[model samples]
Target: MSMFSGTIQTLEQSLNYASAKNRAISSNLANLDTPNYKAKDVTFKNYLAKELSQPLQAKRTNSKHLSFQGEAQPAGYKTIRQHATSYQHNGNNVDVDKEMANLAKNQIYYQALVDRINGKFGSLQTVLKGGR
Candidate 1:
């Protein structure tokens, strides 16, 4: 009885991940000249894969219901620092060419997600308008 479907939720999560990744790429590029600055990256875990691997459990509808114990939801995305590699003599790991490529890729991904969300809203609007 959720208002939003799983597809929408997944799309939202993807959009957030893309935004976070963009920020990380921007930070890396901005600190390209700084010494000892480790390059940062955003990583996303596939929720669908996790869901398929886990068993179904009861959902609590009321506050009085017992909550699930010993289980925690995994983060959809996380920012990690790259400390093992360095491309510059100053101990900076950020590579300009690589960061620029990543920025372009992230921009495309963000645009695709925005287009998808707009399409979803358009379909919802059509349904609300009685298919008119």
Candidate 2:
């Protein structure tokens, strides 16, 4: 059964990206007033572009022939780096409103991706149960 193709892989990657973004936003929000604290975010678009551009090698698990797709994913979130931002008082360039908006949007995207994943699994289950 051919499964987990391009968009599906992209969606899965997006899931992790959004999750990491949520954490980054949370961290910035928590340090709202801390001095010299810079806002941080994962370069999700950049990472996604890189992932999409590369030819996907079949991800493997313990055994060679036992090809479990996406079983061994790359450690991506560790690549997140801080970038320069607009100056502000309290040494914090973390814009709360902007971060909040981004958080909401990322949440919606994450939820949509999760729904799609669930739907795919549900369809698989139905097929396994004799397509009833």
Candidate 3:
């Protein structure tokens, strides 16, 4: 019944995760000189793995609808601070080189997701135009 396929949803979720990861990387770079500022990172792979491993649950359409018992939805992506290592005397763990690399990697990932979504829409558009 849905117009959009599961691939679109997955791409959207991936885009969201990339955006969150970019934010975390940006924050880490912004506070590179702040005292005791621990580096933050979004665990996308782990989150995705855990999410995929879980069974899908039915949505409750109304307040009177019975909820799935003992099934708690996993929380969205989390930004965790790196406290195990300090790269500076101020106790900041953000390494500029590493953050820069991560930023570049994330940018490429974000772009790829965007391109895939655009392709999906393009295909839909073509279909709507009777494959002309």
lDDT of each: 0.85, 0.74, 0.86
- Residue 131, candidate 3: C-alpha displacement in angstroms: 1.2
Runs in model 2 deviating more than 4 A are 6-9, 49-83
- Of models 2 and 3, which has the larger TM-score? 3
Candidate 2 positional error at 132, Å = 1.7
Q: Which 10-residue span in candidate 3 carries the lowest summed lDDT?
A: 67-76
Ranking by lDDT: 3, 1, 2
How far in Å is the alpha carbon of 15 misplaced in model 1?
0.6
lDDT of 1 by residue, 9-79 (tens): 87888898999999999999999999999999997756546754665445777888876534434347779
Ranking by TM-score: 3, 1, 2
- CA shift at 132, candidate 1, in angstroms? 1.6
RMSD from true fold, candidate 2: 6.8
Best by TM-score: 3
Indicate whether candidate 1 or candidate 3 has the larger TM-score.
3
lDDT per residue as tens, model 2, 59-113: 4545755543333334355435355675576667888898899899989988999
lDDT of 2 at 52: 65
